[model samples]
Target chain A: MIDNLILGFQTALTPQNLLWCFVGVLAGTVIGLLPGLGSTTGVAVLLPLTLDFEPVTALIMLAGIYYGAQYGGTITSVLLSTPGEASSVVTTLDGYQMARRGRAGAALSIAAIGSFVAAIFSLILLMVLAPPFANFALKFGPVENLSIMILGLATIVSFSGESRIRGLAMASAGLLLATVGMDAATGTARFTFDNVNLLSGVPFVEVMIGLFAVGEVMYQIRVGAAAPIRTRFRELLITRSELRRSIGPIGRGSVLGFLLGCLPGSGSTLASFIAYGVEKRVSRNRSQLGQGAIEGVASPESANNAAANANFVPTLTLGIPGGGTTAVLLGAFTIYGLQPGPLLFQSQPKLVWGLLVSFFIGNVMLLVLNLPMAPIFAQMLRIPYAYLYPIILFTSFVGAYSIDNNMFSVWIVFVAGVAGYFMKLYDLPMAPLVLGLVIGPLFEKALTQTSALGDGDLLIVLSHPIALVVLALAVLLAAGPSLVRLLPRNTPDREREPAGV
Target chain B: MSTLIRIRGNGEATVYAMLALVGLAAAVSGAFYGVFVDGGRVGPGFLPLVAGGLTAVLCGWLALRGVHGRRSHPPGGPADGVEPHLAEDINPVDDATDDDVDISGRTRRERIHNLWKVFGLTLGAILLVQVVGFLAAFGALVFVISTWIERQPLLKSAVIAAAATGLIYGVFGLFLEIPLPGGLLGLGTEG
Candidate 1:
């Protein structure tokens, strides 16, 4: 293992691979700082170009974008009250409030520090636990995979903000969308409507870009752009007491974030949301939570960053995507003709270790780039949305059209943008819809594969101990909160919707 | 009918009716594709069939909820109860006010007018995309949307349009090397 790590470092230290990694991380930061654009889009847009590079270099670059974007989300959430990604939604609750209260500096400082700490902690944890985790994952079969997906689907309830019924409806809608395209088991088209693209199903990247970026831009235009409040560069740093208040939450969030991140299909966004919920519940200074609590900023900043890096475990070792961003990374791996999984570790030791080492370097590089540049990014807020929206719209078209050099993708983006805007206006959360779009096919495929393996008997899925345990854990993940709420003396309080929905 | 009152008592009751109408549209669209047969016994339409049925049920549920005045209830009490239209933040009376004021209900007409203008801008851009191509269409789009705000002068609008097109074309096309569509009068195909 030590030799492998040293070899990985030696390979990644090459000038070309290191340069590509830097470029990926830099682009990721810029893309992430912008509201609406996210890690998925960043990876998707670059995936085409990365195809021409060496496999290890491409993997290293993609990994940089994955973690770089996580760091970038803090910029927008803290300064603009708009989240760059779902994970940073928690950051907006207190970070924006702190900005409004003239303590933007403290919030920015704490967020940067928290992110750095959490990222380092999660990286170490990943290094320590990855081999064992990979070994355990090798035992998984189609039945266990199906059960795990079912558990994931069940957790969709936790995201039902303000209205349980609405959340359920959204989740159901997601499931229905997932069922689109061809049925992999029977080789039958499900909902193609005669379009060739539909045969493969709705492009997950296109759908996500439409829901998050294009849709968000259109919504912003409809609401009218607000004039930004100006601030000095010196005003973006934290003081002694602020730093002290942040430490405890950051520590707790790091632990929680790493655990949640290790779970396949769960990533930084869930980690941040759960972290914030737990912090609010436990904190004695609850009143300060929504009103600019530094702990709020620290908790999610730490958790999301921790989760972002920790997610690599599943992607690198288990060959499963730990989240949407990792899925894109996995897709990139496949595009380069390399499969990701425990088997890959043995087959492509240099590629695997090189990518892993690059992550540690990327984390340190991101901290250096982000912390000192907080004021610079915050200054970006002064540029009115009128000026910014056009760039966003133009990029939407360029990015969409670039997929296949086709106008059809661009048209799809526009329509999806309009649809997304309406969804926002109607107060529907877009994340669940996105989750359904990405995870839907995987879930259906697993179910079909498992059932087929059982020779038409569904009961065979329960026979495997590993599969049973995973499914049980997934069930616990889905129902644990509700069950805890139902416990004696623990009446669930009215669930408050997380900010930046 | 009496229970189904507006919460803020501002918008037409037809808002709920409109939601029902959209729901009906979804159901109708789903129904059309639900029976489009394919190879399998279940076929391609099975999922859409279930989806359409679910939509109808959920839409019906939402309509029923609206009719029961569930959404009509104000923050303090039931619907139809008399209360100040302005937010407590603006009133400076309630402790809940703090600093955040809800000004969304205000400037309604201006917002609506701007929306219509934006719709006009979008339509014009789509038309332009066909006539001139992507570059010129995008430039024209920036001008139209900016002009819709009514604050910027005509010359400023043109300048903004030029800048927008230049930045997009220059950065994404020239720098990032994305193969953006060059219109009828673009610099060159090499771009």
Candidate 2:
């Protein structure tokens, strides 16, 4: 291990390697900040540029882009309620709420801090436990995966604000919307209504841009922001109490993100969502979550960064892609004339360690770059609503068009924006709907796989300990709260206490 | 009949009813696809059957709750119960007309009018994309929005519109090379 660290340091600390790392992260931040682009697309587009470089150096740079985008994606989510990708969608729930209440700087700052802490924590785990985690990841089959998706469904209860029923209805609508495309198993189109674009289902990214950015901008215009949120420089900085409060969520988020992220196909997006749900279930400031708690900003942001790092574990150790970006990064590895797997680690220790080490260095650079800029980015809110919204509208439309170079996405944005406006008017939560849309496909695939493996019995999971344990967790998550409420209270005072609070 | 009338008139109840209708349609379609089309396998319709059925029942329940709550509470003021659809943060002390009005002194009607105007203009711009091209159409959107609705100076609005268009050009047109459409005017195409 000591020799490996020395070799890793030797490889990563070279002038060219460090320079490329910095360049990669800088490019990644820009790519991620744009509304339509994300880590997978960014790394794919830039892969050819690094083909001439050495394998270790090129992998280091590409890896930087992957993790750095996780940091950049949060910027827009906090400031604009425009998630650069699905992973940051949860951040919009509280981060934008914080910005509206004049704390964009604090929201962005804690995200950066939590992200920095999470990346370091996950990287150490990645370096030490890659082989073991990869083996464990293989144990998570269709049955276990189905249970996790069920667990995700149970977490929708967390996204419900004052009204649980309304949230569930929205989630149902979202799930129905998600089933619009072709059925992977049957090769049958369910709800496409004969439109070619609907065959791919409603694009999640465009829907996010519409429902959050365009919808939010239009709502602000109608309701009228009293003025731009103005704050002093001192107030723009995160308060000490805010950081202290974030400590628990950051720790919890890191663990949840790492565990989920280690599983191939779960990705940082699911990790972030599940992490936020866990925080809502356990945090002391749970009630403040939808209304802009600092823990809200910290938990999901930390989880995504941790998950982004953990994504590499399965990719490096098993030669299996962990998520979309890692899939592209794995492609880059093949392009660089390197084979990835258990044996490759022994053959290519320098490359693997160097890349892992570069994740650490690149994240440190992102923290340095993002921390002070958090307040600077918040200064954008000072631009008056009238002028700013037009610009945001322009971006929203053009960004939609750019996503697939299709006019259909633009229409989706407009309709979703209108829907979003109505939702705001009715005080309906959007988070649960987005979650339903995200996990809908995964849920269906898992169901099909489990049924196939079980020969339609669906009880094969009972025979597998891991699957059984996971399904039990799902059942507990879904039904435990209600059962606990049914428990008898021992004290007369407690029993007599108002159920209102 | 009275409950039906009340539900139609109540925004909260009406929204839930609409959602319930959608859910019902989805559930029926899902059942059709699963049993008739796919022969009852756990295929595409399985999730929709579950989710859509859940949505229909739950939304039906919520719609009833909305109507009962509104009926129990009169619509006049704070002396009455909470308004069914008003945002939680909103104070019901204001007059009914002002329920959705802005503190900026803009009437509800005026704001809704403005919202329609913007929506129409954007919708028009998107339709005009093949003819006038995305750049010109969006530029006009910015110009009209800033000047007509926001009441900015015409010259300033034009400049803002141009700058906004230019930024779009630089980002989508040049850097990303998105192949933005250039229609009759033949402008702003990276290709």
Candidate 3:
């Protein structure tokens, strides 16, 4: 492991790789500061640019964007009271209060420090756990893989907002969309409609660009933009006492966030919310929570960054994405002709290790980049949406058009964008759709493989202990919400915020 | 039935009904491609058929529930309309402002206008790109959207559009070597 780590660092430290990492995180920070754009859009829109780069470097840059956005979200959450990302929403609760009380600098500083600490902690945990998880996953056959994929899809549906029915429908829609091309098993056209473009199926990247980037741009156009709040800069140095107060919250939040992040369907947003809730209940300074408590900013900040980093575990080791951003990364993996799963660890150890090592360096870069530069990035909020939306639309068009150099792909993006807008309007979660699309082919492949292995017995899944257990868990997870609603309530539940990217 | 339909509301019921129809169509098409084969080999359409069937069933259930929910409500009492899970009041990334606007708040004309302005420009750009080339089409899109929709100054719009076009041309066309469509302008090599 040590030797691998050394090799990873050696690859990551190359001048070209390091340069792209810097550019990626820098771009990530800028995008993160913009209220309308999050890591998912940033990664999706920027993915095409990396098509010509080395696979490892491209992955590194994408990872940098992923984690860098975590740090960027804190700036607006603390200073403007508007979270740049959904995961940072909790930070705004107390973070804005701190800013209002003239401790904006302290709030921002603690968030940066806590995020740095937590990211490192999660990365360390990822290093230790991912290898063993990948090794264990290597033993999973088609039956188990199908079961695991079922579990993943079920978790995503269950956790996607309030309407499990709608979520399931969206997942089904995604799965239907995935079956649009020539069937790999039998060379038969399923839903090509005699169009040559449909013969290859929908380009996943174009779908991503359409749903996330173009849809967002259109939404922004309808809802006018707001001016960013300006706050006076103060010393960014955290006081010793504040640091002391944050230590426990940071430690607890990191572990909690990393664990939650590893779970399918529970992304950083939920992790931050849970971490903040935990801190409020247990902190010695609970009275100050929601009223400028430094711990308020610390805990969620740390948890979100930790969660963001920990999200990579399932993505890399199991080929399951926990959220939208990782889904884009998964698509990128396919684009690079590499399948991410247990085999990826062995087949492309250099790419995998290089990416992991880049996380270490990327976090350091984010820390160094964010501490002083956050205030500057916040100024980016003033870039008028008048200019921003046009740029976003143009870039989205280019991205879609670049995929097949065909106008058909571009048209798909526009159509998908309209569909995405309506889905959002109807409160349908987009993450599950993306998750279903990315996982659909895999699910189909696994199902067919399992059926073949079982020799036409549908109950073959039950014969495998692990597959049976996983399917059982999937059933429980899918039903858990309804079951909970039926149970007698002792106390009124707290209003849970909707999940976001 | 009239009361139930009234309570369910036309908009909500129609959306669900449309979804069911689409799902049914998907299922039919999928079945046409063969859902299963000999020796229990799952055909290409097997998963799609399942997905389509599930969608049809689930959406059909939702449509029924929408009407049933209205029927279950007491007369003269507030109808518990079938509400999809509304996202919380917190501002999302795309919507950073505090306005709580919804489609219901706008007149049909207003809604159509907004939709047309946004989608029209986008679709126009898509169609125009193949005719005039990407840069020219994109420039026109930016200018029209910024000036007409956003109501920015014409000069500012032009500058922004020009900058956007340049960036797209340089990055995607030149740097990445992606052969963007040149159309009539012939600025870009045919991809």
Task: Give each model's clash number.
Answer: 2, 0, 0
DockQ, candidate 1, vs. native dimer: 0.16
Docking class of 2: acceptable
- For residues B2-87, write the lDDT of model 3, one tens digit per residue: 73464356444555567777778889888888777768777777888898888788777766766766421111111001111222
B17, model 2: CA deviation in Å? 2.3
Taking the tens digit of each residue's C-alpha lDDT, what string does model 1 give over B1-191? 24344312422223334444444554465455443333223333444455445544554465456555455322221000011121121112122222322233314346546655654566566556645777777777777666656455678788878987887677656665766655565532234
Worst 10 residues of 1 chain B by lDDT: B77-86
Share of reference contacts kept by candidate 2? 0.38
The lDDT values for all models are: 0.65, 0.72, 0.77
**Which residue runs does candidate 1 get wrong by more than 4 Å?**
A40-63, A161-165, A227-233, A284-287, A316-320, A327-338, A488-501, B1-69, B72-109, B112-130, B150-191
- Assign candidate 1 its CAPRI class: incorrect
Task: For candidate 1, state the interface root-mean-square deviation in angstroms to 1 decimal.
Answer: 8.3
**Fnat per candidate:** 0.13, 0.38, 0.42
Q: How many backbone clashes does candidate 3 have?
A: 0
**DockQ leader:** 3
- Candidate 1 chain A, which ten residues in sequence have the lowest lDDT sum? A492-501
Name the TM-score of chain A in model 1.
0.90
**Candidate order, TM-score descending:** 3, 1, 2
**DockQ, Cα level, model 2:** 0.28
